[model samples]
Target: MTQQPLEPGQAPAEHPDAVPLYGPRYRENPAEIFSELRRTHGPVVPVLLEGDVFAWLVIGYRELHELMGDPQLFARDSRIWNQWPNIPPDWPLMTFVAYQPSILFGEGPDHQRRVDAMSGALSEVDQFELRARCEEVADALIDGFAGSGEAELMTQYVYSIPVMTVAWMMGISTTEIDGVARDAVAALDGGEGAPAAYGRLAATMQNLLAAKRAEPGPDVTSRMLAHPVALTDEELVPDLLLVALGGQEPTALWIGNTLHLMLTDDRFSLTLSGGRQSVGQALNEVLWENAPVQAGLGRWATRDTQLGGRHIQAGDALLLGLAGANADPYVRPTSGPPANNAHLSFAHGSHGCPHPAPEIAEVIARTAVEVLLDRIPDVILAVPAEELTWRPSFQLRGLLSLPVKFSPVPATRS
Candidate 1:
């Protein structure tokens, strides 16, 4: 499931100890690999990405925190990467680093503008209404399989909730939400069909933009278009794409991973009797431990700098190892909840997930979990806890599937 060593030789990185960040070893479990990498190479480990492309993973909590705060030293623009020549145009991971005019690569003043506008629009979403909408989405999804007394929650349930909720928030009709959500998840998978899937998403957004521009509504798209910053349709399309993506995939994974934790971990077994609050608690714990986004495209070194005891050269890519940072032994306590919510799950700094985006995601995720538990109180893992397989993705921490069994239940009374 990997490619032959691309380039001059087997060793693609400057550090001799650089290890491939793919293959069976990593797919089995990345925590142990991150631990070993930290132990062997310190906080900043030199690693080879999917195609043996050299990059640095910042695993230390302190180093990652500093990088997020100091964008001057490590910028968001990935076009400065020195290894671009060796990377293929169709590299599966290119969606992360490719130079797009969107907010992902925005810098300084302009980036702040985009962040402000997006945050303003997201803040306008009524939390009460959003939670209600998410509950509806969850209940409808569960109704499809609740009668069978079983379901593979990942694709059937987990992936649909956030995408459908976000798509609805964009004012898409119910009929189109399913198809858009499917294509969006495909795009997020970054697989062979991702380009086409992403193209379809952009086209959908283009159509939405046209509709919103002509006649605005109280939805997210209309709010962004009506923002005083005066974003053109071009700017809105990509920003909307980021909203659909940033809002969908990670949030979906957040719910799925947390559900995985609740079903598999004994600590949460007691909450299965239709508890609602535990959903939020489990969501928080998941953020601290198995952050949905394990890493990011990360910042390019603005100039030669020393960090985590490693001398980094200019233009070197320093990926934010979110799961690694959250698990740093120096910061995380052994037997209790971490002292504070300092985990880098949503990232930090100005470029971090915009102000209200995290809140919106949590609402979507929490309600999805709560509604499912309320409807199917006795859901249990269909497979042994250890038998579940993690998705073969270094970027996202999610399961390939979450098979579960529950008693048959009639649809909601509402």
Candidate 2:
């Protein structure tokens, strides 16, 4: 089917070239496919997210930046979407795009109120303290596998560090951290029982909020409770869920992806081993190439519009192709290191990630990786890079497992 002009209130007709945004094809080697889509179909490619669901995937750097900044035109409030009523609850992407009372799903004044509550709470966090906690967690995790000399970093180290650290920061007891982390991951990767997983997460947050309400502590949850806005339990639960998942998942992926790059790419190896590139460089490179949230949550169009030469009807969804935009030829340099940290991995505009500054997140990731390398200086990938499998999800891009081998050492931490 040819690219024809679409009219207002009409869904973009499914073209023969409509790419499947999910499934194994996208889970593996998404960069190549996204690049081809941008090259062949321009920046805004119409894609089939799931059964009979279609949305425009914004791949161009300039286009995505513009779209993200214009909250009035492209809003995050799914309630305003005309097609929302028609979409089934079981649709795989609903876990992300479905209406929630969190800051992530709000716009305008309501969004600002949520943002203020989160920002005020997160502002009290000490990045140095957070990094120190991450190192301690990393050391503890490494101690678990120090003797074996063979371990899956994703499970043993990378994944656990962020979740545990974020939990600790949020004042969750060590006893409940694992369950919370598991439920949060399940909720984020929408699939069977996602609603139950989300329910469990909400229950966990509700408990945390109640605990904070009764006995306020120095943690983020308490701080948010203590904010001037005085968020209700309904509002607080979803915000806590957003903050916890946002704080942990992507940071974990960054650590894992950076470690993977250091093991597989010679440039990364040299950088980690005191070569020309730095750990920060490797981290930024990974952000550009493999953003943890490869595609951001959907934004609904408030009215009929044209973006990157494609007609978008009112209520049509537009997904910001973050990783694709980073790799776009027009904005991406053909050669050399990124001149500045301008990548949209954290997104842009008013609705971007509000808590845990990018610098702080980078510090947490870099500190964790550095501590691990300091302990096990000669770690190598046990399986080939190609053998590594990514978790199948439309929003998150992360490894299922990253096994590595190293010389055995005694546990140094108690």
* CA-only RMSD, every prediction: 3.3, 3.3
lDDT of 2 by residue, 1-414 (tens): 123334423445455567777777767888898878988999999886766566789989999999999999999888766655456777666777778888888888888998999888888988878888988888888999999989999988887888898898789988989997788778778777777888887888999888888998889999989899988899999999988888788888999988888888986675554532367777888898888888966798888889998887787788989988988878778795475778889999998878555666787788888888888877899988899998877678889999999999888865
- The whole-model C-alpha lDDT of candidate 1 against the native structure comes to 0.85
- Which pairs of residues collide in model 1? none
> How many residue pairs clash (N, CA or C atoms closer than 3 angstroms) in each of the candidate models, in the order given?
0, 0
TM-score of each: 0.95, 0.94
Q: For candidate 1, lDDT tens digit of each residue in 1-414?
A: 121233733454347778777665655678787898898999998888877788889999999999999989999889888778788878877777888878888898888788878888999999999998888889888989988999999989998998888987888777788778788777777777777888898899999999988999989999999999888888888899999999988998999989988887777877788568677778998888788898877899988889999988888888899989988988988876574777889999978889899999999998888888889999999989889888777788888889999899987643
lDDT of each: 0.85, 0.82
Off by over 4 Å in 2: 1-16, 271-277
